[model samples]
Target: MSKIQPLNPERIAQMAAGEVIDSLGAALRELLENALDAQATRIQVEIWPSRWQVRVADNGQGIPASELEQVARRHTTSKLDGCSLGFRGEALHSLARLGSLTIQTRHADDAHGWLATYDRQGELAHQQPAATALGTVVTVADLFADWPLRRCSLPQTRPLLTLVQNAALAHPWVSWQVRQEGQLLLSLWPGQSLQDLLLQVLPQVDLSDLRYQRIQEGDSDWEVVLGLPDRLHRPRPDWIRVAVNGRFVQMPEWQRLIQSVFQHTLPRHRYPLVVVHLRLPPEQVDWNRHPAKSELYLQDPEIRQEQLRQHLHALLQSGSEQASRRSLHLIRASEAKSVYRVTSSPKSPDPAPSGQPSTPLPPLKALAQLYRTYILAEHPQGLWLVEQHLAHERVRYEYIQRHWQPVELQMPVMLEGLSSQAVEQLEQLGLEPEPFGPNTYLMRRLPLALWSEDPEEVQGSLRELSRCADLEAAQVAVACRGALRNGIPLTLEQMQQLLEAWQRTANPHTCPHGRPVYLALAEKDLARYFRRRWGICDRPISDPKLGSWWELEPLGDRFAAQVRRSSSASAPDPKDETRSAPL
Candidate 1:
């Protein structure tokens, strides 16, 4: 066997450090993530032009002075022994190659500290005694100094501040401070909650329509804070943020869930602003699977998406009801359509003729329920599904949710003793159930479908709408309860009528949530399944006796018995063309 050759520590360090600075921000984020994993409650990051320095000092137990040199070197870490959760030597070794890096630490058990530094070439530049407090301080500067193009591309002080600011908001428990050219840009105290942190950074936020929620499913936990439907910052919901295990990432599947919830509420081209954080077990999610880690590998992305959609839809229905009551004077286009001219024409006879009255079915042809999601009715040759409650409430609430219109439909409705902020958020989301006389609003009008239903339940549904967000998130709050009452029976006539109306309605295939209303099985597919010729006769031969036939004898030359079978034994013809004269 050939002798083994050892890797030069200097060469390995330089190469790794180069790679780290190449993906500078991402690499820094990884280190910061490690700090968080370490249970650090406070983190401070600083920048020096092309030179970048990050200091993460935590109250957690510090490393002993004796091991400080080893920790600063390549492939050394204290976090790895407990759980196989983070990097081994990759993070530190990378940092060392890009610049002059150093680590200083002191422990409560040890009175002294040690300092070690690595130069740009990955060689150990120095090791010395140092004075330090009872914690760890890691500093790295001159990032990418050896690579001009990469160094030039590094963000200036201000942009870096923004990056740090965003990260700070994500972890509310960590007090954060930022400085550029000695000018303090962001200095924030510990936040009581995510909302509290948001208020601190985005002071101008219109919380009047905000909603927040926390949902747990098995090993996954999600926190969602959303704005009301109409109050979305853009025509469509654009402001959406997804965080997995506290690391902000772009998750397209998650976006689908939010879009499904906002389908009809906002106008085209507009998007909603949402911030959602998901805490999933690290093993279940493969962060290392990708170079950027922005994209995630979810074991059940579809299921997770559906869950999010359901949660949002429920909120929309509840919010609409409350808003409709408050703005009783408003009128929506849908409410106007409710006053349709009852056609008197006898029209076509019942198509099915199964004693089901030839009801006035809409141009729609089919209705499909996806895991019992928003009902989807066919959109002409296509499919359309309506959010039973959102569509109903939109029409009802739009009329009632007006600011200056007269109470033409919904009367002021009673609301439970909701908090003041919740009431404001409701109105912002277009819920304005007016106060009838203290705590109650005059129950006047409702979504046309809800007219015959219980006003008490409608009110209660709106009250319990967004269980996730503050009751202030009007649309989200009311959407859940406002949805089709689970298991409520509908008459065939009612079902038919609702289906018809939905088929002609805009966005027939989706309710307010972007969930599909129905999936169409094309005509060609039906023919293929039946193995029938396309638009041609070659009809199956039914009666051999009726058609001309020649008799054949057996091999023995004996005369064969001519047994004529009836054509009736063949498959039945779809078309009763027998009534037509023989061609």
Candidate 2:
């Protein structure tokens, strides 16, 4: 290669754009941000044939007639108010360099609008009078054509739709609409409240069921509303929004913080619908750190604490009618103790085919207990050995999973010295203890599948539930606790019941935690290990001490013992090749 030479201005300009625009989605985001920054209240977006063409029109402040073409200049902006969504100047500069750009705008004072079009070099190609309202429309066509490599990474329709949805949710007060190939795809109106707008977005949830709350601290405020569990079948994550001063962003940390609130209420793979808006002074929020202006950092401790407080409150409300202060007082997630309220079927799954005998494994005949822990059972084909504790656990877990339902206590038990909120939170775990006397409550019901469990086992189950993150774990934990305790001798009736229940369960081989419940040893396999199954020796090694080569025969223990005693006192007969054979 020749010595490195300086690149020309044209090459340098294109190189600078490579860092600014990477995909069609990136270009679209820039266009959308610019529209919002212009104070657009009604925005319409149109896309054609995937990433082929895109146009965004906003009814907001428009550029002056004289300075329409100058907008392509680098680092140029009219947003000096500091309250604008973003001030990064690379968006338009990079976009114009990637493909053809057209801007049609008219100021309110202007009699008519002017249209300016440009090629990838940021040079104006056409300028003429164009009919338009008091707003701006920016259209980018031939996306990433100049940079063929970046164009290859173009995303499908889903990603672009997600970007548009985020923009719409960011400005709930703004009327938003979308069109694809002259066909209408989405329409949203600026309604009375955010919930109204969300209702239009997600018709699956009933708007009235969502809980709403507003909290303020100093100059900052947070508005949040969420749907009830019954109505929480949310759509794509694009529907869940977190905006900072009317600007939606990609903040994983904020999303995770919100997810923590609904940990016990929803599965890990699923999420509930929530709409939250954080309004604060522009100076208090920092958006300059990320290239997308998508990440925001909150520097105000008061606002941070308020977020934690409200998050806890919402979690409690959704979790149970009773909110426990003990769990909510801890603001930091590191210190927050995990507590779960059980939400499940109100009754057991169903009685095991009423009065039908459970399928029995007759091969396993119960024999005796070993170490007071394992049950030894005999079988002609094999030996059956089981750990009663684990077996019982598997039996109960499977039974409960099938026959799960709410449970009623045979008699009430009383306990004292717990607060009402505490009791309520506990009841969420399916323990129905109610107030009976001062600082006391009478426990009346338990989780349906585990109602007949020992009180200690029930308490243990609840304690285990506190460590679990979801409902399945809670159910498994309860089952494990209610099962037979290890080292406890079981009566004949109890063991029989356990076996019968285990047989009724769908999965009886392993406990809920995935540990094997029992082991089987085949008699033939055992005989092989004992060296007693060889009918006759095809070959034998000579033993000088006994002066004999061995042969096997179907002889009892007494004959083998006599042969061994005689071999110790006698030498092999030299002339007899059959001397080693046992009769």
Most TM-score-accurate candidate: 2
Per-residue lDDT of candidate 2, residues 155-224 (tens digit): 6767777777766665677888888888898888887666677677766555445776667767877777
Q: Given candidate 1, what's the lDDT at residue 20?
A: 46
Over 413-480, each residue of candidate 1 has an lDDT whose tens digit, in order, gives: 66667666656655543445567556554334443323325667766755554132532233323433
| TM-score for candidate 2, residues paired by index | 0.51
**How much lDDT does each candidate structure score?**
0.55, 0.68
Span of ten consecutive residues with least summed lDDT in model 2: 332-341
- Per-residue error for 100 in candidate 2, Å, reads 0.2
Weakest ten-residue segment in model 1 by summed lDDT? 555-564
Q: How do all models score by TM-score? A: 0.50, 0.51
Model 2 segments beyond 4 Å from truth? 1-12, 233-240, 267-269, 301-306, 309-312, 315-583
> What are the runs in model 1 whose C-alpha is more than 4 Å off?
1-16, 50-60, 81-85, 120-124, 157-159, 234-238, 318-583
